[model samples]
Target: MTIDTLDIAASPMPATVPKRSFLQEVIEDTPGSDPRFEMCIQCGTCGGSCPSGPDMEYSPRRIFAMIKADMREEVLKSNTFWYCVSCYYCMARCPQQVHITDLMYTLKRKAVREGYCRKSTASDAPDFSEFFADAVLKYGRSFELGLATRYHLRHHPLGAIKMATGMGLEMMRKGRMDLTPRRIKNVDQLQAILSKAEEIARQEREQGGVA
Candidate 1:
């Protein structure tokens, strides 16, 4: 499928500012990453497939175009990644197998790492993602109760107590909550793996000349 192109040079922007692009970053970090960005036909399949597309500032198709256009600030500030539900419908429906969902995840990581998430109204999403990652790295699995308590205490103290009071006992009675976290038997090995992954990522960023 062929996609029509627009001349970005005609867009209203200062000529002195060099255009920035992160398509390579997306391909490097996204799971099931693919570099065949040109395969996108602008058919709206991914946008239509997304359940939360309507709530996003830019749909997946438009985000792809922005990426190609090197609209880094706009794309990074967009709520597109936060709105993704990981349903995989977009990826499943894409004729080009573009891995749209994974790309969204990658964009979310980039937004957080580069501090773009601080300017977004959807800061909670990145905060939750970071909290979840920390939890997994520490416990090998999400410690639900601990995570909830920690998150609320840091982000919403008043609401935290209220929410816990309302549902905590009920959840415990139903055996839905555990006060203690269960640690995996091979936690040390998992930590080693994570450390190695981080080391590799640090090396890649250095090699790519990106801070």
Candidate 2:
């Protein structure tokens, strides 16, 4: 499907100030280190299949090219990183086995590290992944509506108020939003699992020595 182009000319470019090179810090020299980027054949298959492409300041194709050129600041500051819906359409369809979703995630981490993220506000906020992780860290499983409400309140205070005053009340009236979070039995076990996984990841990073 062909998507109409947005006004990319009006989009904000990265600041002229010099910044540290996160590219050298996060990516490794090994194969598949940036597999999605390296393997991309400029097929535009990823961009063609992406549902969120229209809303993005740059397509997945352009973003990968920017990364290949080590244009870290320009790529990170683009709206594409924040707009990815994680639908995995690009990943599922890539003939080169490029993990587009993972690449986007890596970009997001770099953006956050550089403090180039959007602030939590009524309309705009950071990604919901952090909120989801926090909920999972607190409880074993996610409570759908509870998580949503908590995220809204924590990030978008005004949005939360409006949500509560309107949609929240409606949902509560319909018994759709649960007030209490359902705890998984033996929550400590899950906590231990999560902690172990995190430790393993850290060890892998240290050993791999990939930035």
**Among all candidates shown, the one with the greatest TM-score:** 1
* TM-score: model 1 vs. ground truth: 0.83
Writing each residue's lDDT as its tens digit, candidate 2 over 1-211 gives 3345665566687656555344444354223545545677888898899997987878998887787778877777787867888999998998998878877877777676566665312124454767777777888777777767778877778998898889988988999877887788888998998899878767876775433
lDDT of 1 by residue, 47-153 (tens): 98889999999999999988877788889888899989899999899998787877787788889888999888777778777888888999898988888888888
Q: Which ten residues in a row have the lowest lDDT in candidate 1?
A: 17-26
Error of 2 at 41 (Å): 1.9
Judged by lDDT against the true structure, how good is candidate 1?
0.82
TM-score of each model, in listed order:
0.83, 0.72
